[model samples]
Target: MKKIFLLAALIGFSPIFSQERDQIRERDEISPDNSWLKVGITGGVPVGDANNASSFALGADIRGQYLFNPNIAIGIASGYTNYFGKDGFDDFGVIPAAGFFRYYFTPSGLFLGTDIGYGFVTNVENNDGGLYVNPQIGYHNRDWNIYAYYQNTFLETDMDIQNVGVGVTYNIRFN
Candidate 1:
């Protein structure tokens, strides 16, 4: 009787063992492989104290990333932001040229990143020079990415500006 009971237990456990083995195999098949160059365009509005006004800006960035492992990638991007105003030359035009480090937290494409660089604001009456740091949170799916970020601009002169913006980026993937 004891032998019969042992045999039944082993038969019932066999399917679970098979499933575990299949899962291991599938995981190995899905291991991370990253070898691609990604380019994207972003457009959004900037709200700040110095501008005291709302303006729209567009940017373009290109990145070359090496996927060391599945979930980790490091890359650099250079981009520009142009701000337009309605009336005259006091409207600030900012060109943001920066480099960034990025990380993916999930395979579904959620990410966190930080960028540091110089922001050249042209056509300003009082101040024209500043540096900026932007920390951002974003999500990417197929060909679309969107983010919300805070920008701190430290001017060479006394006046400084802080901006909060939400942006949408579209990715153009070239094989």
Candidate 2:
């Protein structure tokens, strides 16, 4: 009777230990990766010293970033801005090109970004370029994005320009 009971217990537990589905999941269960080009439309008013000589501004930016990991990305960013004329200065344009990075903090696409490089200021007659820095925060998604950012340009002989703005971006994939 003891030998029969031992054999019954072994047979009952053998299938449970040998099951493959309990140790592994299906391969196609994860979400697709996000890495692509970004085109944005932005508009906002100049702030601080920039507002002293210029009116509101409108701008656009382009970026190509690679999602190196799920939460981080690095790439190139460039922008074009036009500030309205005011009493102290004529209308001017701003162009900045920089190496940028974005860091996502949540699973739902909240992120912070920063960029540093050179910026160009122009009124078609006299042009000057200098150091640039940009910082941003918003919700970044694979399909769409919305952000608020600040632009700071350090000029060689003129006062630094500071503009604050909000933007919307769309993500596109070729394949």
Candidate 3:
């Protein structure tokens, strides 16, 4: 009797399980024309004259890109980067607004990219924004990106801020 009951239960649930599997298979199909947003965190140590004032750096950013094909893309990115102060210095930050370009070595993994724009200084007075450039290399897949970048900001005050950093982003797709 117990063996017969077990058999009956399996039969009852088999159709439900198969239906779920079919739904998953349908959802797994991805289209090439989709755009994606990458949301992530970034951190770095100050280089050049920036080291004299900042001990380290940390920030977050969001980037949206439209794929022209499997390998090339263009996008815009914006984020905040904070430079922690050294002794007797106050912490400073920059809100960076940039346009970026990327080339993927493969359809979904490994790429090169760069951002060019302006960094608006924050938490300081009597200052204008600066030129911002970041060149990066990374591994990208359907869901994540891991990268290393060099960031530079050329200030009008005759100072240059530089950083060598690593960042990670999670990709969210839209049709």
Candidate with the greatest TM-score versus the true structure: 3
TM-score of 2: 0.76
Prediction 3 global C-alpha lDDT: 0.87
TM-score of each: 0.62, 0.76, 0.79
Order of all candidates by lDDT, from best down to worst?
3, 2, 1
- Against the true structure, candidate 1 reaches a TM-score of 0.62
Worst 10 residues of 3 by lDDT: 25-34
C-alpha lDDT of residue 139 in model 3? 95
Better of 1 and 3 by TM-score: 3
Per-residue C-alpha lDDT of model 1 across residues 1-175, encoded as one tens digit per residue: 9999999999999999999999776654422244445566555566655555436655565555554555665656556555556444245655666666667787657888777777777776676667877788988665565777776667888766555666665544434
Pairs with backbone N, CA or C atoms under 3 Å apart (clashes), candidate 2: none
Candidate 1's error at 168, in angstroms?
3.5
Error of 2 at 134 (Å): 0.8
lDDT of 3 by residue, 15-56 (tens): 999999997766444443448888999999999988999989
Q: How does residue 97 of candidate 3 score in lDDT?
A: 92
Off by over 4 Å in 1: 1-37, 86-89, 125-128, 170-175
Two-way lDDT contest, 1 vs 3, winner: 3
Q: Candidate 2 on 1-175: residue-level lDDT in tens?
A: 9999999998898887666455433321222354577888888889877798788988888887777667887879887988887996888878988999989886567999988888888783443878989899999766877999898888776577889989888876534
Better of 1 and 2 by lDDT: 2
Question: What's the lDDT of the predicted structure labeled candidate 2?
Answer: 0.80
